[model samples]
Target: MASIRRLVLDVLKPVEVATVSFARELSDLDGVDATAVRLVETDREVQNVTLVVEGEAVDFERVEACIESLGGTLHSVDEVVCGEFVPEEHVAHADATWLR
Candidate 1:
């Protein structure tokens, strides 16, 4: 079976939650080796963030729960990286032309 190597998400969250704390929390999830959180936009009430999660196999459900528990909402799953063996070149040149 293929495993999830990476995931990128668009998230809307309250301002109280620090991105570092959020990233650290996600890093603790099963199969998640690392996490990167970037603040795309910010407002008085909420923050828009780009979340990048990487690991051998990322359990998305758990990730969602974690976000919710932290008073955040997952707006969308923007990118996903999954395979038994993901090559670096493939990641660099990700085109859906193979579907043709």
Candidate 2:
């Protein structure tokens, strides 16, 4: 089976909890090496967030459960990286080249 090494998710969550707290909680799960959550947009009661999770083999079911437990709704899976050995992208220059 191909191991899930990276995942990018779009989530909608209540504002009561902090994104860092969610990241910390996700990082505590099995196989999760790290997590990064960024606020994309916000309304009065909820925040739209983009979540990036990295692991040797990410348990997606557990991750979804964790999100629900934290009062978050999974919107969509934007990106995913999975394989026995996933290659990392390295950029020589720090510029918005991809955007141009």
Candidate 3:
């Protein structure tokens, strides 16, 4: 099976946990190499965040568990990359309606 190389998740987290701490904990996961947490939206009780995680073989279960432990809910898996290599993203040309 191909290894999971990257994951982009939409998460909702309690404001109590700082983004820095949440990102740091994700980066510390066994198979994770790095993490990028972007604040998408926020309210008095929760924050909507986009979490990007990259690694040689990211463990989705562990990532999900960590988020839950930190009072977060996984809203959706926005993106996922699984293979021996991570593919570069390409922008669709204006004339390429089919690609879009």
Candidate 4:
């Protein structure tokens, strides 16, 4: 089986949990080399964030569990890269019609 190299997730977390702490915890996970969390939106109770995890072999189950432990909900998986290498994503002009 191929290893998971990267994962992009949409997560909703309680405002009480600081994004820095959340990101640090994820970065500490085994097989995870780094994590980047970007705030997408926020409200009084929750924060919407996009989390990107990159590593040699990211463990999805562990990532999910960590989010839940921090009182966060995984909204959706936006992107996933699995293989021996991570490739740069390319978008053709025709495929980006919505950008105009």
Measured by TM-score, the strongest candidate is 4
User: Which digits, one per residue and each the tens of the lDDT, describe model 2 over residues 1-100?
Assistant: 8889999999999998888889999999999999999999999899999999999999999999999999999999998889876577767677747864
Better of 3 and 4 by TM-score: 4
User: What is the C-alpha lDDT profile of model 1 across 1-100, one tens digit per residue?
Assistant: 7888988999999998888788999999999999999999999989999999999999999999999999999999998888865556445355556665
TM-score for candidate 2, please give it: 0.83
Where does candidate 4 stray beyond 4 Å?
Answer: 96-100
> Clashing pairs in model 3?
none
lDDT of 1: 0.91
Instruction: Report the lDDT of model 1 for residue 63.
Output: 95
CA displacement after TM-score superposition, residue 83 of candidate 3 (Å): 1.1
Q: How do the predictions measure up, each by TM-score?
A: 0.83, 0.83, 0.88, 0.89
Among all windows of ten consecutive residues in candidate 4, which has the lowest summed lDDT? 91-100
Off by over 4 Å in 1: 85-100
Residues 1-100, candidate 3: write the lDDT tens digits. 7889999999999998999988999999999999999999999999999999999999999999999999999999999999888688887778566644
lDDT of 1 at 68: 94
Which has the better lDDT: candidate 1, or candidate 2?
2
Clashes of each: 0, 0, 0, 0
Task: Give every collision pair in model 2.
Answer: none
